[model samples]
Structures are given as structure tokens and as C-alpha cells.
Target: MDDAIIRRHLSVGRLTILEVLHDEPGIDEDQLLAEWIRRRPPASQAHARRLPRTIAQLLWQLRNLEWVDDTEGELTITALGEYVREFARLHSPSPFASRTSTVGGHSA
Candidate 1:
């Protein structure tokens, strides 16, 4: 996969985690994992098993990107993260566009 695609997945993962935390601030890691599994039921069992590591990786990436701030067991989305999430939503692919290949530059 392209680095950009990986980056986008990291961003999306971070955004999803942040949104979950926003809904229930001060959640512990286990709670976070449970919530993620509940939200993304289609995720494979292996994926679910690896969620903690994945989330940690995403969190680290988000921290490096300045998209989140954490201290003393509390985490919060930074202004940059909020802006990115909003921008992503605004530019999200249309559901009906799947028949085309404009997205991600795949010609059909």
C-alpha cells in the first residue's frame, strides 16, 4: 500500500479513537478496546486481538502528527486533529462512487 494510504488509515484510526474518547472521556484501555470492537464488528478476530497494539501505534502516530495531546492518563484531541477530522468528513468519498475509479487513482 502507498504511504499516503497508510497515513490515511492511521489518521482515520486516530480520529475514530478520539471520537470514542470524546463520547466517554477517561476510558481505560480495556474499555477502549471493547468499544472499538463494538463499533467495528466486521473486524476480524485476529484484528480484534491485535487492537491494543494497533491503537497504541495509531496513538503514537497521532502524537507525532500533533493531532492529540495526552497527560496523566487523560487524552484529548488537538485543534489540528479536529480540523483534520472535519476536513476528512468534508472530502469523504461518495457511496455511489464505488463503480468508478477516481478515488485513489485506480483507472477502471
Candidate 2:
């Protein structure tokens, strides 16, 4: 299988945030952070506590890429973001394609 498109990007955090935005557009920072924390694996929950900083950094990158927009306190994916997200899903290795997909080429 081919590598994920994330290989060409800054960090996995960037790809991760974009995936969340694509799934739940117009979510505010708090909501976004909460969702991210909630989605963390049980074993990762402790580390997930640092998600705010990570989310901030990722949001910066996404904004710099013009892939996300913040308006009226809500975050939403841009046209480019949708395109990138879709392209990544279609072209990334099956394991990394979908947000809910597991490592063994199956949905979680």
C-alpha cells in the first residue's frame, strides 16, 4: 500500500485536526478539543491532556495552508481542506485513509 498523503505534510497533528474538521465542521475550539480528547484511546488519555497546545499548533498550520477557516467562533473546513481531505482518503494507504479505519485495513 502507498503511504498516507500526510507524509508530504508538516505533522500527523495537522492531518488529524483536518480529519476532525472534515467530520464535524463548524465546531469551536473548545468543542474541537473536547472531541479530540474524547476520541483518544484510554491508554493515551493522560497524554491527550496536552491536546490544547497541539490543537493550537495544528490550527495554525491548517490556517497557514488555507485549509481551514474560523468565523463567528466556529471552525470550518475550506474548499481546499475538503479537497485535501478527500484526496488523502482516496489515495492514502487503506489503513490511514478513513478517520475511523483501523491499522489492519478495516474500519474501527
Candidate 3:
């Protein structure tokens, strides 16, 4: 759940899912899909909107990692999940951020 653990496994989509679960505990798969797509960038929303069936796979990975719990059609973050989410927000730079900008006289 620390920055190093997160940075090693980080992906924008995974991070978003964790954050969503943090804010919307007990959400269902259907609802999580809708919310997830809603939170996605406009361009990806169109593609994600067509892949409702893939939600299970996404949730499966998170569950397998012990980052989330799905019980009785409801989802919630585990303590480690919340820690990952908060660490991402407070310690990680946006994965999608424009790294083309210069830093320390070198392009990031």
C-alpha cells in the first residue's frame, strides 16, 4: 500500500477503480461499470460503454490482489485498497500527466 508498492503495480485504470471503491463503498458491478465509465476520459467512455461484460474481469483482478471485496453483489475497498488509493492521490503524479514538460533542465 505504500508508494513503492503502488508505483510498481500502478495503472491509471486500476488506480481509478480503487479510488471509486473508496468513495462509493458497497457499489454493485453494474453501478461500478457505469461509474467507472463516467469517470473515464471522454474518448474511452465510448469504448468502455460497450464492454459491460468485462466488468467481472476487472473486478476479478482487484479481488485476486486482495484490494477489493465483492459480497452479495456489493463492492468495497479493503484497508490495503484504501491505502493504495490515498497513496496514489497524495504521493503519485498523474500517470497521464504531460511528462513532456521540462524538469531540472531535462524533459520529463
Candidate 4:
């Protein structure tokens, strides 16, 4: 686990955003959101209502952390983000690592 990634306190949503950007570096926000929603849909109708705002906030936070960059309405992961993704992939107990994974006594 990387200290930089660990310090980010990344949630599943944020992690998903990073992974998607890592896979598709120049996708726009709509595409990214669509993929994220497809992969991790909201819990309920109410959650779906709040999903856009929440995802926006998460993306905003990642931007502030310099993990992602959005230029001309397209998003791309930074090197730091790739580092985080690699750490998550390696440390994750299962596929598409969860933020709450308890493997190796690491939970974040």
C-alpha cells in the first residue's frame, strides 16, 4: 500500500473513478459517470437522486488531490492516480478492491 494512496482516504467511488480514468484516459465526465454508475449503481431511488452530486464531489476531491485532471471536458488519471490504482490492485483481496478491505491488516 502506498502512503500517498493511503493518505488520500479513497472511497470505492473515488477508486472506481481512478480505475476508469486509468483505463480510458480521455473519457468525458458523462462517460466516466455512466461507467461508474453501471459498475456501482446507487443503493436506492433516493441514492440515485443523490448519485450525481456525490460523484461530482468525489471527482472534485480527486482533482484537488491532483489524482485526476479534466481538460476540455475530458478526464485523465495522473501518475499519482496510477500509483494508487496499482496499490489497490495489488492489495485488494478481491477484484475491484473495496475501500473496506481488511486484508493484510489494512483497512481504508
Candidate 5:
């Protein structure tokens, strides 16, 4: 997949979902949504109520990308999903990178 398309398919929220899925395979939607809600900052707690809808949309997007497999009410990360998760981990910007060196140690 094109890097641009891959990046476009991921946002902080979606990437977070992917990461969680990668870590916990076969997690049900409800449990996944609850976990996501629990991770949100207190100020964003208001959005927790919308987790069901948000997670549905995110899962749908990931499904379209073939990164996630929704089987019998359980979501599993596909091989592609694992690849994207690692890609994001490697490419995501770090707070200290801009001030000092890139996460990969290249001068930013």
C-alpha cells in the first residue's frame, strides 16, 4: 500500500484501536470499546459514551483496509494489520525527536 494511503487510514484513534487489537487478538467489540474508553483522558470522558459508534466506524475502516478481521463478533488483527502497527511504531513522531534526534537516531 502507498505510504500516503496507509497514513490516511490511520489516525491517533484508529492507530490506538489497531495497537490494542494487535496486542489482544480476538477481542470482542464491547470489550475493545470499553478498553478504549478507559484509556481516554478525563477531559475526554464525555466522548466515552460515543465509543460504540466511534469504534464501529473505526473497525469498519480497518475492515475495508483488510487490516482487521471481524469474525463472529470478534475482531482479530490480520497480518497486514500487524505490519501497519509496526510501521506506525517506526514512523510515528516522538516528542524528543524534534528537539534532539529522531527516534531512529537520525538528526531531525
Candidate 6:
């Protein structure tokens, strides 16, 4: 995967979550998880299990960054997050090709 794409996804995940919640207030964790899962492409069982934990961590980080407001069990995106998302989408990676690195007999 492209590093830029990965970074964008990591950043956008939080924004998307917030956007969804904003459109539908009072959404719970389960609903958030479900929507995230639905948005992702089909994956293996192992990947499916791991995705939730990854998303949880991302949400935690966003909360720590003060880009999201978590009250009770609900979440809302801060102004900073919305602005960042807009900027990121404007500067998203190209769809042509990306750089790769080879290390320790592995290609990344």
C-alpha cells in the first residue's frame, strides 16, 4: 500500500467517523464500528477482527489530539478535525504510482 494512502486513511478515518455521527446524532460505538466495517473492502476473518481495534486506537488518538469531543458514549468532530480533513482531501496522493522500499528481504 502507498504510505500516503495509509496516512490519509488514518487521518480520514476519524473525520469520516465524526461526519457520520454529525449526520446522525446519538450514534453509539457499535454503530460506529458497524459503519466503519461496512465502508471497508472485504477482508479475511483475521483482518476483520483487527480492524475494530485499529479504529478504536485511532479514535483514542484523535480524542487525545483534541480533534474530537467524546461525551458519554457519543463523539463529535472538532473544527480542527474538519479543517484538516478538508485539507487532506485536497492534497491526497496521486492514483498513479508510489514509492516502495525493500528491506530485510521484504518489499514495502
**Highest-TM-score candidate:** 4
Task: Write model 4 residue lDDT over 7-107, tens digit each, in one string.
Answer: 44655666788888987889988788788878877668898788778778988888887889988888999988787777767866563454344433443
Any runs in candidate 4 off by more than 4 Å, and if so which? 1-8, 95-108
Best by lDDT: 4
- Residue lDDT tens for model 6, 1-108: 343543434444555565566566566678878877766543678877887787688788777766667789887777765655554455555321222211111221
Off by over 4 Å in 3: 1-3, 41-46, 96-108
Locate the minimum summed-lDDT window of 10 residues in model 3: 99-108
Q: Candidate 2: worst 10 consecutive residues by lDDT?
A: 99-108
Which 10 residues in a row give candidate 6 its minimum summed lDDT? 96-105
Question: Considering TM-score, where higher is better, how would the candidates rank from best to worst?
Answer: 4, 5, 3, 2, 1, 6
Instruction: Estimate the overall C-alpha local distance difference test score of candidate 5.
Output: 0.72
Q: What is the per-residue lDDT of model 5 for residues 1-108, given as tens digits with 9 covering 90 to 100?
A: 876667666666666778788778889998897777666533355665676887799889889999899999889998888887787788876422232232333221
lDDT of each: 0.60, 0.67, 0.68, 0.74, 0.72, 0.59
| Worst ten in a row by lDDT for model 4 | 99-108
RMSD to native, candidate 6? 7.5
lDDT of 6 at 71: 89
In candidate 2, which residue pairs get closer than 3 Å at backbone N, Cα or C atoms, i.e. clash? none
Higher-lDDT candidate of 4 and 5: 4
Backbone clashes in model 2:
0
| TM-score of model number 1 | 0.67
Model 2 CA lDDT for position 63: 84
